[model samples]
Target: MTYADVFRAEWGQVVATLIRMIGDWELAEECTQEACAAALERWPRDGVPDKPGAWLTTTARNRAIDWLRREAVGAAKLQEVAAMTDEPPPAYDVPDDRLRLMFTCCHPALAMEARVALTLRTLAGLSTAEIARAFLVGETTMSKRLTRAKQKIQYAGIPYRVPPAHLLPERTPAVLAVLYLLFNEGYSDVSRSTLSQEGIRLARLLVELMPEEPEAAGLLALMLFHDSRRETRLSPDGVLITLDEQDRTRWNCELITEAEELLDRTLQRHMPGPYQVQAAIAACHAIARTAADTDWPQIAALYGQLPQTPVVALNRAVALGMADGPGVGLALVDQLATGSLAGYHLLPAARADFLRRLNRRTEAVAAYTEAIELATTDADRKYLQKRLVQVSVQS
Candidate 1:
């Protein structure tokens, strides 16, 4: 990897380790930024270090210490360092600390929005503006949320350590949910800035750091299974392409194989968690040679057995429509439309597609128009517009 790439890759580790040592999330974040600035200035002539992660950490630590010394107010921080002066610095190689950082950022004491903003800023390397745009909010709002989150972390004395194994069952699911939210934020056009690439990258990181965690593995597999279709999910003109209409030949076979293997292994562990079940459903699609070959019945059955989340149910309904008919999918979509998802554009978007399939052009056109009106992002709006056009022309 190039130096820039290396810096980006090590950014989370550097920030995470500093947060552990400094016990101040905002200060650590600032120190990490300062360290990167210093690296940019010096690395060209000093050359990359043998262990860049350690180099960044030590450099950030020294910078923080120097600032504290100058201020003459960090007696406690200084004393803590002095007490540990003889000991070798803790290794940043364990890598699980980054995941721990995620848990810390998403701690329930903070508001959910704050957790998301802070997680994106600290762990995911997203800028405040980038995060604001993802959430369809103004930058100032996102900035305040992040600031409050960091302040809360400091005031609440939130420890930067992974929860214990006994506590894992209860807490780890929240961590998985955050990552899942992160993945979807990137996967969907609504929030994605990078080509679902960020989501895939983050999911891969989770699996790498927590290889034994079945949910992490399952989530990674699920992302890959769906991401393999990214190239064909949109047309050249950026219109949304339904799964059955997508060119299966363009799917990434290698990713499909890997996802299948991961799903198989996860299934054998005998842990029938939400992610594994979802991965199993995606696996049915991966195994299909052609759209016609997709075992819609099996997918529908898996959806029935899967845990009840609105998004999962929504997806299952879509699959059922494809597997069974628009009547089944429309029924589910209608229920969603009547309730919490009233403002959600995808509900209408999905309804439009199913309506079009059912030759209900007038209703399809109206649904597509509603989706376009509710769309938050330019890409999604454009996609909905195109759908509206197609249905209008058909009518």
Candidate 2:
């Protein structure tokens, strides 16, 4: 693999290991970056090492030890680092350094937003600017958020290891939520593909580490199901394609089959969670040969089982509209319009579709215009703009 690839794949593990060894987050990050830079300069000449991860770890740990020595930070920690250097790298195992790092970054003590941001920055190795752009915030804002989060971790004495067995049930949800958001952000905007893939990779690791956790498998299944349709999500001209309009032939059957298998395994456990419910909904869509064949009723029922967040309620309304009538969906949309979903683009977009289906051209046009104004992503904006033009002509 190229040096860049190695750095991307191993940076988090190296940092996590160094943090565990040296108990200094900043020092770990600094040493990891230096190790990566050294690899970039030396690998082309010395050739890639037999074990890139081990090589990087050794190099970074050595750097950390040197820094510790220079700082004169007591003999105890220095002795720890010196011993770490002497020991051979352990064999690859189920619960790797990255998984431990994920749990640590997603600690419940951190705010939910802080958990997501720190996971993306530390585990996924995304730049502050990249993360800022992904979340549609300014770079300065994201920088401060990350800095504050890291400071909190240090000052609050948050342990860097994975939670104990009793704590896993309570802690895993936050980690799963962070992964879900990371994948969603990437899925929504093609520019953030790395985040989506990183999310899947980490989710897979989580499942491997905790096979008894059905929700972990469910989360992975949900991501795989969504990823199966990635290629068909947009048209050649870069306009967003609704699920009904997408060419099903272009969908990745392999990923769909794998996701189904995962869902089946999780269902066998007889423990349904939000991720499992969402995965089942995705599976319902995947198994359908055409949009008309989709099990909207079943999907709606699945959504009903989920906690009624504004977004879930909005989605349920759309499914209800499809299964019942546009009027049913429109009534639900109207109820949400004055609530917390007032400014959400999808709420108006859903309203516009329901109105258009009911042949209320004037109302549809208005809703489409509102949706266009609030649309966030380029794809969403383009799709809404197209809908606006069509509805305007009809009006």
Candidate 3:
């Protein structure tokens, strides 16, 4: 493979392994960058090796040894390097190292915003601008958040290894949140690039890295259920189509089946964690042959049990509307309006939907206009603006 292709495929593995070896996330990232730079210069001439990942790993290892020899010159670390001379060095294939990195990047010890910005930057290769767009924040603010998160890690000495299995259950929810955030960052059209494929890739990687973890399985299932409907979310004219308006024939049956099987297996574990419940909610939609056929009542029930994350409650309210009536959904949306979600776009959007259903055209148009003002993406703005137009014409 070309150097570019090789680096893209193997960069995460090399960086993850280096972080494990060096016990410093920032320095390991630097060493990997330096190694990739060296490979670019040398590989075209020396020719790419058959095992490029191993080649890159060895190059980075040697670079780290050289740095430590000059700076640290310690006894134990020096002995560790010397021991590495006789062997090709073990494959960087430690299980769950990536998961460990995810937790570190999104440690709750860090600010919630910082956790998200750092995870996307370090794990998914997302830029500050891209992350900012995801949350409707300025790029400068996102950059600061990322920088602060890294500093916190450096100062707090967050370990680069996964916690012991006995501690896994306590920590698993945080790990799942990281993966979910990662998938969401990519699943939506927050950037010029379509991250849907990338989201699927990262989800698969996390599940592969932590095969025995039920939360990881739930993560994969959650992503699969959403991904199955990606194509159906857009019209040929590039308009955003609501799920109830989407054509079920466009959904990916294979992905749906895979996610269903995962949901079944996840249920056997029966810890009923947040991700497991979210996946079950998605499964309700996946099993339906049509939007009207969806089990909205079951979805509403799952959402009721979902964690107290505001987004979860907001989503549950939408399902409640579909399952019950606009009154129930509107009450929930109205309740959140005075709470933490006062300025959030989805609240207004949900309010608009309920108003429209009740034939309150003026209020619906105003709510849609507020949603449009709050929207970040051009796609979302256009969607809300169009809804306003429709309501105005009807009025």
Please provide TM-scores, in order, for all candidate models, with all chains considered together: 0.72, 0.75, 0.73
Worst 10 residues of 3 by lDDT: 85-94
Q: Pick the candidate with the highest lDDT.
A: 2
Candidate 2 residue pairs in clash (backbone atoms < 3 Å): none
lDDT of 3 by residue, 1-395 (tens): 45665775566667766665666667767777889999989988998988887888788888888888889767786666445432333334324445556654555577676766676666665666767766656778777777777777778887755545455555556556656666776566634233456556656766675677777788789889998998777666667788888888889999999999988887896687777888888888888878789998899888888766677788988889988999889988888887657667888999999999989999999899999888756777877888899999998
Question: Can you give the lDDT of residue 175 in candidate 2?
Answer: 83
Alpha carbon deviation, residue 295, candidate 2 (Å): 1.9
Candidate ordering by lDDT (highest first) = 2, 1, 3
Q: Sort all candidates by TM-score, best to worst.
A: 2, 3, 1
Tens digit per residue, CA lDDT, model 2, 1-395: 45676787777777877877776777888999999988888988999988898899899988988988899999999898878753534544436555566776688888877888888777777778767755556779999998898889889888876666567666687788778877887898775677689889989988877788999999999999999999999977778999999899999999999999999998997779999999999999999999999999999999999999888999999999999999999998888877767667788899999999999999898888898887768889999889888988877
Deviation from native of the Cα of residue 168 in model 2, angstroms: 4.7
Model 3 residue pairs with clashes? none
The CA lDDT of each predicted structure is 0.75, 0.84, 0.74
| lDDT for each residue of candidate 1 in 1-395, tens digit (9 for 90 to 100) | 56666666677777776676778777777888888888888889999888887778777887778777887857898776434332333444234555656765666677677766777677767678767755656779889888888888888888776655455445556567667666666666633535256566666776775678888889888988988887887767766676777888999999998998888887788676778888888888878888889998888888888776666678788888887799989988888766546666788989998999999999999999998987866768877887788889989
- lDDT (C-alpha) at residue 14 in model 2: 79
Which ranges in model 3 have alpha carbons more than 4 Å from their true place?
Answer: 1-90, 93-116, 127-145, 156-172, 190-194
Give the Å shift of residue 306 in candidate 1.
Answer: 3.1
